[model samples]
Target: DTAVSQTPKYLVTQMGNDKSIKCEQNLGHDTMYWYKQDSKKFLKIMFSYNNKELIINETVPNRFSPKSPDKAHLNLHINSLELGDSAVYFCASSRRGSGNTIYFGEGSWLTVV
Candidate 1:
């Protein structure tokens, strides 16, 4: 089975639309995160969860939200989507604490037109 899985590998939406992406991991990791990769290939962490608790939230727009039901799952919801929101989102997991190898999902590509 895949260590981590994300739903709707591709998403196309119009400005102001609302969307959500779901992710799950079977790697038994304690921490999970959401990362965004822009068109120019710049990667940035948007949010992080440790054992189902919100831990790290970056300076992302208020339109983005991350939810973790358990240590193995993390989901992202976006409201009032904008063209700047277009990017590839990646779900990742790692052991609790810091300095651990993180595993990533294939990525959910979001496009706003």
Candidate 2:
């Protein structure tokens, strides 16, 4: 079975539209995260959830929200999408902290026109 999976590997929408991306993991890991990789390839954490609790990165905009239905799933919702928001969103899972290796999904590419 796939350890982690995300829907709509590619998304193209006009600016100001809202979009949501779903992610699921079967690794039984307690910690899950949403990351945005910009055009420069800089990966930055947007949100982290463990046991249904959220730990958000300060740099992330209020337009981005992360929802975790359970330990196995974490989804991202974006509102008022802007041209600057066009980037690759990746769902990842890890045990916790810096000790564990973060495993990433294939990534969902979002393009805001």
Candidate 3:
């Protein structure tokens, strides 16, 4: 079984379009996160949820929304997506607390053209 999985691995849209990506994990993890990779290949965490509850949002824009329906699922929605939003999005999972192994999904590539 797949430990972590995300749908629509590739997305191409124009500026201002809204889109969403879905993610799920089967590792029985208590914490999940959404991270974005910019063109320069810098990865940054957008949101982190523990047990389906919001725990961190590192100054993520309102256009980016993270929803964790349950411990195993975390979905990301972008409203009026901009050109700057084009990047690779990754979903990850880890145990709660400090110094736990983190597992990541393949990644969702979004392009604004």
Candidate 4:
């Protein structure tokens, strides 16, 4: 069984369009995160949730929103997508206070035209 899973592994959309990526973790972790990998492969944390509570929210644009309906599920929604928004979105999970040990999903590749 996959520890972390996300839907729509690849997405191609036009600018100004809205889209969403759904993620789930079956590892029973208390913390989950949304990470973005840019063109240069520089990874940055976008949002984090612990037991369905908002925790770490990075300095991302208001267009990017993360919603966690439960500790095991966290979804990312992007409004008015822009070309610069093209990147790999990774869903990750880790035990609270586990210190750097994180399990990542296969990643959702989004391309904006």
Prediction-by-prediction clash tally = 0, 0, 0, 0
Q: Write the residue-wise lDDT of candidate 2 on 9-67 in tens digits.
A: 99999999999999999898999999889999999988899888986565788999888
Evaluate residue 27 in candidate 3 and report its C-alpha lDDT on the 0 to 100 scale. Answer: 97
Q: What shift in Å separates residue 64 of candidate 3 from its native position after superposition?
A: 0.4
Which lDDT tens digits does candidate 1 get at residues 80-99? Answer: 99999999999999997767
lDDT of 4 by residue, 1-91 (tens): 9999998899999999999999999999999999999999999999999999989999999999999999999999999999999999999
- Clash pairs for candidate 3: none
TM-score of 4: 0.97
Please identify which of the two predictions, 3 or 4, would achieve the higher lDDT against the true structure: 4
For each candidate, what TM-score against the reference?
Answer: 0.97, 0.95, 0.97, 0.97
Provide the global lDDT of candidate 4 against the true structure.
Answer: 0.96
Q: Give per-residue lDDT, candidate 2, residue 42.
A: 96
Worst 10 residues of 2 by lDDT: 52-61
Stretches of candidate 1 exceeding 4 Å from the true structure: none
Runs with alpha carbons beyond 4 Å of true place in candidate 4: 98-100
Q: List per-prediction Cα lDDT, in the order shown.
A: 0.94, 0.91, 0.95, 0.96
Per-residue alpha-carbon lDDT of model 3 for 37-79, expressed as tens digits?
9999999999999999999899988999999999999999999
